[model samples]
Target: MKKKKLLLTTALVGTMAFGATIPTSLAHDALGSDVNKGEERIVFSNEDLKTLESSLLKGRKNVGNFYEAAAVQIQELEGVQNNTADVYAHNGYAYLGTHTANGGNGGVRVFDLKDPSNPVEIAVFAHDVPYTWQEKVIVKSVNTPHFKGDLAAVSVQQTSRNNSSRPDSVGGVLLYDVTDPTDPQKLGFYQLDRRITGTHELYLTTQGNRALVLASSPYADYYTHGENEDFQIIDVSDPSNPEKLWGSDPRELEEISEKFNGYHWDAPDGHTRPVFNHSVITDNNGQYAYVSMWDLGTVIFDIQDPENPVYLGRTEYRDDQKGAAHSAALARGGNILIETREVSNPVGDGYEDAYGYTRILDIKDKTNPVLLSEFTTELTYDIPETSQGRTTFAKTVHDPKVHGNTLYLSYYSGGVIMVDITNPNNPTEIGRYTPESANVWGVFVDRNYVLASDMGQGLKVLARGNKVVNNGKGR
Candidate 1:
């Protein structure tokens, strides 16, 4: 076991100040400067943990009342573990990813959703990955020449930044042949370079006869010492032979530096914000990609040719607004884009005392995305002035999933917020569900039911109608 100490201060303490915990093996080191010098490892000190505990306590106080409109929780499954990270619903099943909490070894859990209200855990995949955790899992149906049927892609990240040099460490994408939900067969793994940790987020889609995966490697340049790119496109037509098609480096893009050069308020205490791809998603046709570059805004690229990506444009933030361009989803015939900003620091220099919210953008013109409207919950805007400076994991918006004209947002402590995106310009909250203690990480809207992954809780199945069919017993 090895330990890496981080000398974190105000600026360096963004989302890391939340509930992110490192393994005991990786203890805190106080040998460096007050600010992080691009070290990949994320370790917190006792003081930081105290701050998190205090923040969570204060945040729960403001969790508000339990409310639901046009939606009801039909089923809930406290997963095999407590650190569930994300969930993806497909066909008649749900795949849940886990984080590196409690222990470093965490994997994906698959559930049978035949009975929407009574999901049963059928199989668990990739739990054998040593010293690793999975944050994103996406399963897509492929009909390419090399493969056909349901394919699952799970992102594996090493628990410690320095663990990449160890032989038993796992850091990459693990593919699985989950055509059979009850029994998933291991297909292949697309391991990241040693210098790079692993894929934080990814989007799997099919283009023509080829199946492609757009993997976002956050801060890859800093970890790899500027030798690798942050965004990678891989051709997984054959699950057993996943090949890299191309990579996109945000630092090379002139627009990135040009648009965010003078944005100091969003930067860490005394440091400049680093530009890198935090997450990515493609259009329905898989011809274009929207890469969420933190502080750089959501960058758009033409990926018709997987090998060559053409830069189009990106969304911008006002000088006073904190930019964390976290994750995004397209809606309304691909004309409307919903971008969620994950501002971990509620009150900071030159910024308001508020958590991140959803930003509605009109991307009808690929060259320029115009901000249509901004949506924020009462918790995001009304945090107590007493708890303004602390980091609260409960308030910020994490992920968004759109179905038809509705936007299902997984808001941390705010729970799952259902918004009417029929009119992107004037977005209105049509419904919301906040558990007694909610920490929603990812959300997915399938058919008539919605699946939300809560970090503290587990798999939550909610539907629009009042009568949710429950044939079997809870697992």
Candidate 2:
């Protein structure tokens, strides 16, 4: 008996085309780890074309219309490449990340949101690194002993697994001083091992006088062959001197093994479900950290002590559920959690019948979290029978943002769907803003309006029309 080995190969197609001179040593490496395994290669086979056509047709069918109670679009700023990734709003400005889907160099785009209806592009943080992409960016106002101003942390990842050994290739987090959004000054770069690829998602928090950055390195153990941890905490209290404070692999924890009885290592579907950290978010006080583990659910950690973190309990999924646990947000004074599962392939291997949706959990009991309820939209369960087994990225929920009792979600082609989670157990859809050709990747709620990052159409400023009443504190 022999073990099955999977090798990733890149096919030249559109702007994702690769060069003919692929290094032989790098050809056998896997594309990525966990949920993003083997996604870099853009092979345009017959089946691939069929899937693309199906997604486009589905988008067209539901295009150019808004829900009766839909939020009105105030303004839209087209992206430089129309390949926007994630968006973050702070103070009176909006920052957007760039993707490598169209062979464009990754960077951070800044816009002045002072005038909500008219966002002005103020600056662009050009990422000169070749063969890499910046998919996530988060800006936080810090008042530390060394640096006290606006700090931006951007996640950088290699575009392809085969280019790991290229001299020009780089992977890690880039820090910038954006206190002056118009002229962002480079502070420092936190470099990761080449084998680890890079950080896919990041979060910044201020623990007292010390500021820290929590980075999620997806499938790091698989790539390094158990040599490194996937989640890392870096002490960025001094923007110029970024140092690693702590690192941990959730799978190696005793409580995780005992709770699931080691079932996470080898799932019942005859496939090895590798546990990896997909994304992370911390409480307002930075006392606890919630990590979104792809197949092992969301693992909680107590980080009151920056040097040492204690393992808390994690969320659980049913036997029939394909565990993704992509991203999450905290609400209701950090007692409730909004978890979004990006299950792009939803109709095979005995999985559910629809795309990913929102799951509300009561985390008041950190040691033993409880599932309160689940929220789904028409696109989540209304997949056509013909597109059941085919993989499409257009219909799944990508991110979550909460303002008061309202929950905003980025539903790719399904557009932005809003829900009223006043009752955690029974969330109801209150509003939506679906554009003519929407491919929204992220959503952010501000004091006055909401900002959505659409991959194809760029930044869209939306008004909830007094629907969002600040009855409770928002995340």
**lDDT at residue 430 of model 1 (Cα atoms):** 72
Q: What is the lDDT of residue 81 in candidate 2?
A: 38
Worst lDDT window (10 residues) for model 1?
1-10
In order of appearance, the predictions have TM-scores of 0.79, 0.80
Count of clashes, each model: 3, 0
| lDDT, candidate 2, 101-190, per-residue tens | 556454888888776656787887848667677778999999999999999999888776436367676678889999999999999888
Worst 10 residues of 2 by lDDT: 2-11
- Clashing pairs for model 1 are 5-29, 11-269, 394-413
Q: After aligning candidate 1 to the native by TM-score, how far in Å is the CA of 173 from where it should be?
A: 0.9
Q: How close is candidate 1 to the true structure, as a TM-score?
A: 0.79
Candidate 1 root-mean-square deviation in Å: 10.8
